[model samples]
Target: MAKSDSVTRSAVLHRDTRFVPKKAVGGKGSYIFLEDGTKFLDSTGGAAVSCLGHGHEEVSQAVINQINQISYCHTAFFGTEASEELARLLTESTGGKLSKLFVVSSGSEAVEAALKLARQYFLELPTPQPQRTRFIARKPSYHGVTLGALSVGGHMIRRQPFEPLLSSNTSHVSPCYPYRGKKAGESDADYVNRLAEELDGEFQRVGPDNVCAFIAEPVVGAALGAVAAVPGYFPAMKAICEKYGALFILDEVMSGMGRCGTLHVWEQEGIVPDLQTIGKGLGGGYAPVSGLLIGEKVVEVMDRGTGVFRHGQTYQGHPVACAAALAVQKIIQRDNLLENVRKMGAYLEERLRGCLGDHPNVGDIRGRGLFWGIEFVKDRESKEPFSPETGVAFQVQETGLDPSHGISLYASNGTVDCTKGDHVLLAPPYNVTKEEIDIIVDTAGRVIEAVFAKVNAA
Candidate 1:
C-alpha cells in the first residue's frame, strides 16, 4: 500500500487538504494501475472523461506528431491544420447546424465562451436588443466552474459559496428530472408542459425582451445523476425560447460527443439548439479540449457585424490538443464504438436492474448509452434521500475502491436538493465488453450492499 505521509508532503494543492489520494502510475483500457501494483476497474471513466480510455497509441502518436510539427500558435496570428481539421470534423458531426467552433482548453472555458457568444449574438443583430442580457437555465444542472459559467449553472451547493461573486443576470427553473420533479400521477406531457410554462414564466418575470438565452443539458449530469428529460420536454422548452426570441443553448459538456449513444443528444430531441457547448468526451481524456459550437443564425449575425468573436484565450486552439482530439474522434469512428456503446449500455442497464432493482435503498436507475446513475434513498416509496451527513454515495465509491472490490465509481450527492440525495454514476469506456459490464454491475451491487449494511449496523 502507498504511504499517506510521504504522499501528503507535496507542493500540489489538492482538492482535499485532509487526505492524499492514491497514485495511479499507469492505465490501459478499462483498468488503472497504482504504484502498489493494484489494479482498479475504471467504471466511471474518471468522471466520464476517458471515453477512449487510457494509453491509446493512436492519440498519443497524434499528439507526438503535432508537437514535432508545431505545438503552439497564437490564434490571433496564425491557425494550425490540427485545429482546422478538428473543427471541421466537429462541425460536420453536427450536420453543419453548428457552423462555427470555438475551441477551448476545458468545459468551463467552453461554457464561458457560450455565455459570451449568446450576449454577443444579440449585440450583432441588425436591430440589436442590448437589453437582452439575462440568461435562464435549469436547476440541478452544472455548466462549469468559472465565474460566468458558474453563474449560468444551477447546482445549488456548488454555487452557494460563490453566490455573492456570481452574476445576477442568470436565473433558474425546474429541470426535467422526471424521477423527482414529476407530480404523483402526472402524465409525461403534463409534466413537460408544466416545466415549459415555468420557463416561460421565468422569462416573463425577467422581461422576455431582456432575456438572451435559455441554457440546459439535454441529459442532466453530476447534480442530478444522469437524469434525462421526459419525451417532448426539449421541444417544449425550445418553443418557449423561440417565443421569447431567446437563444436555445444546450450544455452537452458531459453528455455530448457520443456519450449518449448518439453523436449529439439533441439529435434525439426534435429541436436544435442555437448555441451548444461540448467537452469531457471530446478528446476522450487524451487532452484538455472543449468547444462552443455556434449555430448558423449566431454565425450569420457575427459575420454580418464584426466578423469576429470578441473573445480570446492563449490556448484557444492548442495544436497538440486538437491533434489528440482529432485522432480520438477518428479512432472512435473507425472502430464503430458508438454501436458498442448502445449494445453494452443496454446490457449494463439490464444487469444493474437485475442485481439492484429490489435493493431497499435503490431509488431510481436512469441514463442512456454508457452514462448511468444509481440513486439511493432512505425509503424507496417516499423517495426520501439520505441526510447529507450520511455521505452514502461517497461511502459506496470508497467501498468500490477497496482491494476486495478493485473498482472505481463516480460518487455524487445533492441529488434531491442541494445536499440531501446520494448517487453513484457508472460510465465505463465506450468499448467496454459484456464481461466487463457484468463485473461493473456485480461490483457496484456489492459496494452498495456493503455500504448500506454498515449504515444499518451503525
Candidate 2:
C-alpha cells in the first residue's frame, strides 16, 4: 500500500522533525516492508530488540490468548499467572543467583527500579546508613532515559539538556574502553587494574560510606557500540564495589536475554550483580517488557523489612507483556536459539573482519555473540574520529535505508566522548541464517563504502 502525501504528514511526534520517515507497512522474519513496497533487511533488529524477528506465530498467539484470558490486572490487587511464570523462568535461568524479579514495562523502568531498590536496601539494613546515597557509574555508558537512570548514565549529549534536573549524587569514572582508554604499551592486566583503581578512587573521593551502588553495562551498548571490558575488568570492578560496601549493578538491557549467546552477559564475565536489569530481547519485540532481577542479598534485606517495594506502575506486570516475554523465552529454549547465536555470532565477526577489516576509515570492528559494531575514523592509524559535523554514522544509516540499498543499520555517535566518534551496530536476529548474514555484511560494506565515497567527494 502506498502512503498518501497527507499520511506523510504524521500526527505522531517523530525522532526527527526535519524529515518524515517512510512508513513501515509490515514485517516478517528479518525484513520490514515499507509503505512504498521497499523491503529492508533489519540488520540491527530495530536497536537489537527483535531477537525472534517479526511475525512470530507462537509469540503472537501467546499475546492474543493472554488478552482473551485477562489483559490487565493491577499488581497491587493481585498477581497474574503470566507474570509469575515469566519471573520463575527468568530467576531459574540465573540459577537462583538473582532470586527475584520485578517486571516493568521498559528498560528505563527496570533501571529506575534497580536504583530505588539499591537505596531502599541500604535503608532496610539493621543499622541503616542514610548517608549511603551516592552512585558511581562509568562514562560513555547508557542505562536508560528516565531521570534516575539518566542521572547514572554517562552519555553527556543526552544528559546535557537535562543536567539541571539530574541528581548530583551520581559521579562517572572512565569506561573500560580498550580502543581509546588503553595505552600503547599497557598490558590488558595493567589497563584493567588502572580502571579498577579509578573506580576505587571515585569511591574514596565521594566518601565510600556515602555511596549506595556502582553501576555499569557488562557490554557497553549503543553509547559505546558493544565495547566489552578486558578479561579481569568486571571482577576487578565488582571487587572495588565490594570493598566500598556498595552494591554492584549491571544494566544488560541491550546485552542480556541471550543477545550475547548466554542467557545473561554477566554469566560470561564471571560476576553476579547485586541488581541486574534486562530488556530489549526479553519480549523479542512482540511486546513491551523489561525486568529487574534482584539478588539473594537484596531479597534478604527486603524480606527482613516490610517485604514491599515502594515502587509501582499501573502496567508493572501486564499479563499480555509477560505472556509475550514468556513465549519468546520458551521458543529460545525449545529451538536452542542461543546455540545458533554463538555459531552465527562467530560467523558474523569473521565476515565483518574479512569484508572491511582493512578499510582505511574503518577503525575498529568489535563485538561478541550476535552483536557487533563498526567504528569509522578519519585516520585509522591515529584512531582519529571524523568530525561530528560529518555525521558519518547517520549518513551510513540513511544510505543503508535507501531503497537501492534496502538495509537498516543502527547508527550511534560519541564513542570518543559525548560528541566525537561515529559507529554503526549490526544485531540481526538470533535465528538469522548464514545466507542472511552474508547479505548483511555485503550490504553493510556497500553502504559504508558509498557513504564514505560521498564524504570524500564532498
Best by lDDT: 2
- Every model's TM-score: 0.98, 0.98
**10 residues in a row with least lDDT, candidate 1:** 1-10
List pairs with backbone clashes in candidate 2: none
Of candidate 2, the 10-residue stretch with the lowest lDDT total is 1-10
Deviation from native of the Cα of residue 248 in model 1, angstroms: 0.4
Estimate the overall C-alpha local distance difference test score of candidate 1. 0.90
Residue 269 in candidate 2 has what lDDT?
91
- Candidate 2, after superposition: displacement of residue 203 in Å? 0.4
Kindly list the per-residue Cα lDDT of model 1 for residues 1-458, writing each as its tens digit. Answer: 22266545877776766557778999999999987678989988998999988888888999999999999989999999998999999899888999988899999999999999999989999999899999998887889999999998888889999999999999999889888999999999999989988998998899999999999999888888999999999999999989989999999999989998988899999888999999989899988999889999899999999988889999999999999889988988999999998999999999999999999999999999999999999999999998899899999988887878988878889888877899989999988999999989988888888899999778
**How many steric clashes does model 1 contain?**
0
Q: Candidate 1, residue 409: CA error in Å?
A: 1.3
